[model samples]
Target: MITLQDLRKVYATRSGEVVALDGISLEIPQGQIHGIVGQSGAGKSTLIRCLTALERPTTGSVVVDGAEVSVLSETQLRRARRRIGMVFQHVNLFEARTAAANIAYPLAVAGVPRAERATRVAELLDLVGLGGRGDAYPAQLSGGQKQRVGIARALATEPAVLLCDEPTSALDSATTRQILRLIRDVRDRLGITVVIITHETSVVREVCDAATLLADGRIVESGPLADVVTRPGSKLSQALVPVPDVGVADQRTLVQVSAGGAQAQIAHALYAIATEPDAHVVAGAIETLGGVRVGRWHLDVPDGDRAAVLGRLRAAGLAVEEDVA
Candidate 1:
């Protein structure tokens, strides 16, 4: 339930005017995890700040939960911000405060009662898988634990939308996975809209339903994760997931054979195609995505037998294609 239309944010420096965001228009639907991915200085941070009203956009409109955030006064913007929660990369929790107290801080500021705040904090801790760690201080917790506490604190007020700014950047791979799982769980259970800004494609692949790729202060690509990852074209896509290598050999055809079972089928197919003395397999790899084995095999076959090999693969009920240059 967030929309940005022709949102532009420019900054004045000693050199000249810098366009941090150049006409970025985006829509984040409710109850879905949306990601903004790009390299450093691609306006990812600027976009998030503009959305949160921490930095006002130079032009265009920002509508969040039906309210025009761009036009709201300072006092009104503060009120609007309460409906949006943010989790920073550094897990910005008070060092002296215990986990429960850190979470209670938001409710405390919101004028929530002590008993209700306690209950809410407890529920949040449980939701973030830190139920019994409420008594621990931030110093005693691991990176992942601190982030969970940050998440609990962010959700203390039960905000409708959550903005994560490189939430897993500082954590190790294991910790990153834990934090991503926690974020996914929160989104699924609360139906809260999540907008994650990260440069890591692995993070987006694991958690995001859809993503937008930003470059040179503009959106270069935006689509569903699977479609964007599998289809080649976008520069962002190429940087994110690498395509399988298909070798080039003159006077030979590249035949792709797909089988349902394990590597044995691949070996059998190679054997069947071995009748041609010139047949050779250049590259192969098997990867499981969405619980299916999507294997890619590149074969170098003589020009004469290329059609016949393709015919045999098709007769076996497998998807076959010839690479034509």
Candidate 2:
């Protein structure tokens, strides 16, 4: 239940004013896992900060659960922030504190009683799959473990919204999946809205229900993950799932087959047949985009009259198109 309207954030730098966020407007539904994806300096970090009120916007309003966050007083914002929890890239866990204490720190600051804090910390430890590691310190834990602790701490207050800023950017692929699964679990169990900010689309594909693409502090595209990823020849599609960049040969026809699920399996079989004398596959990149198996197969045919072959692929319920590059 978060909505941003014409959001803009500007900073007074030595060279006039710099706009970190340029008219970013988004609505994240409650109990859904949403992703804001872009490269660094794309206003992803600034957007999240706006949500947590760590950095107020220069113009526009941020409404969370019907509360206009931008208009809140400092004291009101602090109280409102309790209902929103954030997880950072580096996880910033206190080295001196044990995992249990680290998770309990927030509650401790909020004046939670010792007995209550202990119970909450224990429950969170188990929730993050660190039940037996509460006694360990940050130095004694792996990168994933530290993040687990960070998550436990974030959920310590049972916030209605969870904002994860590059939550698994530092972890390995396997660990990243584990963390994503954990975030999903957190959303499912708590029924809380989850917003993830990442530079890579893989994270969104693995976990996000909806997504928005940001470039140069502006939202270039916003829609269902599947729609954005599957739109042929769109900037969003090319950026999210890269196709071959090389130009096609005049003697040979360039064909790209983009499909998902069962169609992808059939595409593999058809590509096997494309290895025949009439046509041959140049290069292919098969990948999962928006949680669906999709690929771009660059096929080269000797004759330009591949209309029959292309028609056959399309007749089989696959997406086939002639590629320009």
- Clashes in predicted model 1: 0
Give candidate 1's TM-score.
0.79
Predicted candidate 2 versus true structure: per-residue lDDT over 1-325, tens digit per residue: 9999999999999989889999998998899899998889999999999998899999998998778999899989877887888899999999999999999998987889999999999999999999989999999999999999999999888888999999999999999999999999999999999999999878887898888889888998887766765665555565666655656567777777665554656466465546444656677666666566666666676565688777666665556666545
lDDT of 1 by residue, 1-325 (tens): 9999999999999999999999989998998898899999999999999989999999999998888998899989877888899999998999999999999998998889999998899899999998899999999999999999999898888888999999999999999999999999999999999999999988887788888999989999987665554442345445554346776767777765544344565466555545545557677655433222334456677788777767765665455556623
Model 1 off-target regions past 4 Å?
A: 244-325
Residue ranges of candidate 2 with Cα displaced over 4 Å: 244-257, 260-280, 285-293, 301-325
Worst 10 residues of 1 by lDDT: 287-296
How much is the lDDT of residue 133 in candidate 1?
95
Displacement of residue 79 (Cα, Å) in model 1 is 1.4
**Candidate maximizing lDDT:** 2
lDDT of each: 0.81, 0.84
